[model samples]
Target chain A: MNLYDIATKLDASILTPKLDLSRQVHCAYGADLLSDVLAFTRPSTLLLTGLINIQVVRTAEMAELGGIVVVRGKPVHRSLQELACACKIPLLRTRMTMFESCGRLYQSGIKPCIKDPGCECNVCPSV
Target chain B: MSAPLCKKEFFVQEFDFEHAGKAASDMRKLLMDYGFDQQIVRRLAIAAYEAEMNMVIHGFGGTLIMEINFEYIELVAKDNGPGISDLKLAMQEGFSTASDEIREIGFGAGMGLPNIKRCVNFLGIETKPGQGTVVTMRVDLGPDAI
Candidate 1:
């Protein structure tokens, strides 16, 4: 799905709509642990996170994630927004819980960002 | 002719959450501008950011240096006093020494060093208790660098 579709499915408000929302996201990774996200996530994947901080944005930037969906309606810090804009990564906020957001996206055909046993993408550890 | 070795240094302050990953971001941009492969650039950026954050969260801040040659990209993060007491323990996954405050901001998961090691071609650490610590990470460039 694209960023706009994911936004609609989750009822999320785009915090950085000024940035492009037409990018395709084939996979999604949901995690609040910045370390885990950095370690396991793939490029251009959508990130579902509950945390809002500079590090979160930085994680998205370093990982080259396509977009971010903040769950549970957490108020995003201004610095986070500014950095998101600077990094050009779309930021979305949803009132739904992380579980709900993940479920809705998964049910809509968004695959989990899991590394299969036969995967050779050295970044992610074997499942 | 081989490209000249390029180097840049950034100073990170302890608890400076405001600009924690600036160095890493800047280094990534520099490497990209130099025409490095996307995969190599991303791997170097991840390792650089982890090293930079390690200084901000664990040590008394430090200087992060990025050196790029035709063959490899190297990142050297040197921090001030309060070095690692046990290198072996620090290298293990899920072995962070960060406090509650750091954890609340979505860091300190004890995966920094391991993450760096995974992203880089070589990882090295030198520390002296009550002195300081230096972490050196390198990612090779070329066809098989990825």
Candidate 2:
């Protein structure tokens, strides 16, 4: 689904609405550590995490992630927003904790990136 | 897909998480504009960003040098001091010695080297504690090139 749909489902606020919120996301990868995210994330997926730094945006850009969802009411830096704008990806914020947001997205048919869905990996919120 | 096209260098500073991925993003943008495949550019960017982070988090900051050719993309990162004591251990996933300050920013998971290795076809690292580290990563375009 698109960012607008995902944001509505998770009670998230879109930070970059002009970023073509119409981009579809097949799955979501939730991780605070970028290494795990890089290893496990699928292209065109969304990145869910509590980290709100420039590197996280960089990781999303590298992984070609569809967008970013910052959980737990974290404040996003201006540089981060600029990076997202330059990268042409949407960034969203939610008062929802990482686990809760992932659970919400997962229940909405947005499974993890594992090829065989439900393959038991911790990267995607299976809780 | 086999000719040297362009080169650029990005300077990174220790504890400078604010601008960690600038080089990678710029490089990826240039490659994408040059018509490289998304996958290739992404792979190159991942490795490049990881190496640059290592430089900032572990050493006295350094330069991320990117050399792009038709056949491959090469990333060379050279830092000035406080090199890794053991590369073998550093290469292991989840092995990290990042300070608490670095970890506070959510980056010290010890996956830097491993992640870099994962994205590149060839990886080389040389370092000595108290001196510095130099890393070289290469992603081959493979046998099929348009």
Candidate 3:
């Protein structure tokens, strides 16, 4: 689904609406670890994270993620909002917990970002 | 072996979470402005970012130098912090030395170096305990880059 659809389905409040909401996102990854998000996420995938630091936005920018949905009703700081806006990454906030948000998004047809079974990267044992 | 097409440097301060990824983001923008391949630019950006974050989280600040040549782009991150005593241990996926404060902000899960290695064409580390560390990452500008 597109970002706007996800926002509407989750009843999220858009923190950065200047970005194009019609951008399509094929997958989603929920993680609080910035490194894990960097390691596992695919390009243009949406990120559902609990962290509201500027690094979250920076990580999304570096990984080229579609957007960010800050879960758990956390207050997004002004710096985070400014960076998200400058990067043109859509930022959303929801009162729902990470699990609930993930479940709802999954029910709405958003696929999870997963490693390929045939992948050969041996660094992470979880892979 | 001629002069590079472009060269730039950025200073990263220790524990500077506020502006940690600026260098890497600037590098990505520079590559995009240079019209490099999007995939290659993305990979380089990830590598640079991981390196930048490492300096912020672990090291005592550093400088990031980028040299964009016709055939390749290289990023060298040097930090003057407590160097890694065990390079092998530090390279592991789930091993981290970051403090509780660092983890509170969603970092220190020990995926930085591996993520950098996963993104770049070549990765090199040089460190001296109690002195500093330097991470060199390179990505070629060709179809074989991955």
Candidate 4:
């Protein structure tokens, strides 16, 4: 699914719609730990995280992920929004908790990182 | 290695989460602008970002230097923060000295150094208690690099 679809499905708020949301999200990753996200995430995977910070944007860019969905109804700071705007990484906000968002996306047909085909345990569920 | 095509430096201030990843992002832009291998460039960017954040979250403040050439890219991150007390312990995954504030900012899970080591080809560490620490990392441009 594309970012728009995910947003609609989750009823998320688009914090930085100016950033590109054209790219398709093949997989989904949900984690609060930036370290785990950076370590395990693959390019084009949509990050569903509760942790919102500038590093989240930096991590998305470095990991080559599609975008970030900040869960838990947390208010995204302007700095975070600005960074996403500058970097052109799409940012979404959702009232749904982390687990709920991940489950919704996973059931929507998004998979885990396709880089490792052998493991289909849905660990992070990337495409 | 041949003279670096370009060398750039960035200052990272302790507890400066606001501008933490600027230098690393700059390095990414530089590498991409040079048309280096995409995967290699991503790895370098990750290393750079992790190193840059480490200095900001753990140290008082520091500088990041990027030296780039066709053969490789080297990143040096030096900080005036408390040096690692145990190199071996610090290198282990999930080991962290980050304060609660840092963690609240979405870092300090004890993965910064280890993550950098994972992404780079070479890693070095120099430190003294209460003095400072320096981390040197290198990522080789593969044979396919133009």
Candidate 5:
């Protein structure tokens, strides 16, 4: 789904510049653990989490995640937003809890990206 | 252009959770500029970030020294804090000593050291209780390795 569609579905607000909402989100990962997310998420997967910290942005950048959706109406701190902007990763906020957001996205046909064969260990997959 | 060999140092403050990943991010950029392959750079970045996180959350404070050469990139993180008493337990996938506060920040999942080991070619750890710990990680950058 596109960014616009995701924002509308989750009732999320864009915290970064309105760039090409046309970016394709092939998969979604809903987790607050940056390490798990880093270990699991494939490049370009949208990240859904309740954590609102600078490390989130840093993890997104390192993993080359497509975008980040903060759940439970969690506010994205300004510094994080700035980092997101600097990294060109979209940041959004939603009042919906993580479970609801994941369910909604799954119901909408977004699936988890295929895990890298190298990541078949105990690490959580980005699905 | 031929790849550039370089070394840089980063000082991580004790419990400075706010800026933990900055050093790794900077190092990643430097590796990119040195013309390292994207996959190599990404692996190095992940390893470096994990090491940096350990410094902030577990080591109390430390220095991360990174050296990038043509064949490999090496990260040496040294810290002065209560050291890891049981290396075997610490290397376990689900063993963590991080406080509740660190867990709340979405870390302390016990994957930091393991992930670093998984992403790099060589991983070494040295620790003395009440003194500190030093972790050395190397990522091979040759074509076959990538």
Candidate 6:
């Protein structure tokens, strides 16, 4: 799905500055731990988390994540938004909880970016 | 090792979660300025940030000393605090001693040591209870390693 579809589906606001909504989002990761996300996530995956801090932006930059979806209707700070703008990472706010957001994306054909071929997540069909 | 091409020292205040990743970010910039490869730079940045956050979350105020060479980069984090008793367990993926408050800030998922190990070519940890912990990590940029 594209950013526009996700925003429309979840009633999310495009918090990043001047993003192209047509960018395709292939997979999504739902986690609050930046370290875990950095360790496991692949590039261009949309990150869904409840953690509202500056490190979210930094983690997205380090992992080369496509965008950030803040769950639970939390308001992102201006500093984080500015950093997202500077990093060219699209940031969005969603009223849906993390589980709900993940479920919606999964039902919409988005999967997790699993690097390991032997992993057994249903969305990740054996790499 | 010889003298580093560039060496930077940072003092990380104890229990300061807000400014934990600054040193790592600075190191990333330095590596990029030195024309390091993007993969190497990313690995070093991730490893450095994990180590730096560990120091902040677990150790007391400490020093992050970075040495960048033409062929590789080395990050040495030394802190004086209550040290880890079980190095093996500490290296586990889901083992964390970070408090609830730290968890709320999007860390303490018990991936620090494992993530650092994953991102570096070589990682060494030395800790003695009540003394300190010294984590030395190196990422080589040679043709054979990459």
Winner by TM-score: 1
Q: Best-fitting candidate, measured by DockQ?
A: 1
Q: Model 5, residue A88: what's the lDDT?
A: 87
TM-score, cand. 6 vs. native = 0.86
DockQ of each: 0.87, 0.53, 0.65, 0.52, 0.57, 0.41
- By DockQ, highest first, what's the ranking? 1, 3, 5, 2, 4, 6
Off by over 4 Å in 5: A116-127, B1-4, B144-146
When 2 and 4 are scored with lDDT, the better candidate is 4
Against the hidden true structure, what lDDT does model 5 obtain? Answer: 0.85
Quote the positional error of residue A48 for candidate 3 in Å: 0.6
lDDT of 6 by residue, A1-127 (tens): 8888988878898887487768888988899888878877776789999988988888887767789999999978898898888767899999999989999889988888676666542212133
Model 4, range B23-138, lDDT digits (tens) per residue?
88988998898888877877888888888888887778899999987677889999998888999999999898888887887788988888888788899999999989999999
> What 10-residue stretch in candidate 6 chain B is worst by lDDT?
B137-146
DockQ of candidate 5 against the true complex: 0.57
Clashing pairs in model 1, backbone N/Cα/C closer than 3 A: B96-B110
Tens-place lDDT per residue, model 3, B3-96, is 9988999999988878899999988998888778777888888889988888888888899999987778999999988999999999998999
- Model 6, span B1-146: residue lDDT tens: 57887789978778876676777777777777877776677787888778888888888868889987767788999987799999999999999989998888888989999888888878999999999999999887677433
TM-score of chain A of each: 0.93, 0.89, 0.90, 0.88, 0.88, 0.88
Share of reference contacts kept by candidate 3: 0.83
Q: Who is ahead in lDDT, 1 or 6?
A: 1
Q: Alpha-carbon error at B82 in model 1, in Å? A: 0.8
* TM, every model: 0.95, 0.90, 0.93, 0.92, 0.90, 0.86
Instruction: Give the better candidate number (4 or 6) by TM-score.
Output: 4
Give the alpha carbon lDDT tens digit for every residue of A1-127 in model 3.
8988999888999999788889998889999998888888878889999998888999999888999999988999888898999999999999999999999999989988876577654222233
What TM value does chain A in model 2 reach? 0.89
**Candidate 2: clashing pairs of residues:** B1-B70, B2-B70
**Which segments of candidate 6 are over 4 A away from where they belong?**
A18-24, A116-127, B144-146
